[model samples]
Target: MQITGYKSQGVAAAVDLVNAVTTVEGDASFAALREILRVNGFFWHEFEERDAEPLRRWGRTLREFFDAAELETAVSLLNELMLELPMHPHLADHDPHGLHLHFAPPTARLPHRFRASTLMQLSELVVQHGLGRTGTCAAEGCDRVYADTSRAGRRRFCSEACANRTNVAAFRARRRTPRTPEGTG
Candidate 1:
């Protein structure tokens, strides 16, 4: 895939993974982690007993990207992460999807790979599209994070359901508004 395609995919996967970690209840079990990794195109192997902590830390860092108060703040946070958790970039074709760039070394641990790839991709995305592309849902009572990949870059909600619900609520509120006493004025 093209670099932009790869970056977009990575941002999407990162968002999904972060959201799952933050929104999902219960402890981060091996099965849950495996499922999240699988959905994000990461191959899951037999996880070590201590793997959950690193994954949680990674998720916390990823969540910070979305929770940033402004674009510059988000960029700064990402840069700080890049400096703290460096990734050794090297070419590899381990996947059947064909040759693509890999950020971490082949022997890196799963948490390291997850952190490196997602953070690198997120940095590229922010550099290419600005930190405004990442945001929380605008719908009431829904704070899910989403990567705004639309061409127009006007996305406001995390999902269509939230958008629809917000719209419907607004329409109902407008209809219920009282407008009268014009002639008395």
Candidate 2:
């Protein structure tokens, strides 16, 4: 249940990207994407208008990781994506983060850097935890992805709102169900 600091951040970023892209009201705008990266702590020098499409495609691929029904399947998908992506792993001591890994080269473009870092971090998370820790929300009509970093690993919704909604629905359903009186029925 204890995810490493950087890995935890990476998983959050990955889930955020997937949810941002796969949601029914997904905003694929450049500004939104930039905000996601910035909030995720991506150390990018610049973001270009041309980077949107590639980033969107990467988000879609990350979404597929949650679609996996099993941990092995998710690992396979991660492996495939790592193979397809162009990453050059190296160590860096930039911005007072103090000696962390960078998957893409310093000269790489924004999309490439984001892709490499997100994918590599998520892969590490899958190895440490399991594919079960990542999934789409179980609430009806809500398809947002989430990373279950809970101690019990029982999280099934993207947010408290979705979880509360589902719990309320279930409560209402149980209340509506007819009960047998003293086993007479």
Error of 1 at 59 (Å): 1.1
Clashing pairs in 2: none
Could you tell me the TM-score of candidate 2?
0.91
- lDDT agreement of model 2 with the native: 0.83
- Each prediction's RMSD over C-alphas, in Å, is 2.7, 2.0
Q: Candidate 1, after superposition: displacement of residue 140 in Å?
A: 1.1
Give the per-residue lDDT of model 1 (tens digit) for 1-185: 22255556667767776776776433356677777677667756645657767887787778888988788888889889889986899887765557677788878888888888888888877777776678888988886888886577888888899999999999999989887778965
Per-prediction TM-score: 0.85, 0.91
Off by over 4 Å in 1: 1-4, 24-27, 46-48, 179-185
Worst 10 residues of 1 by lDDT: 1-10
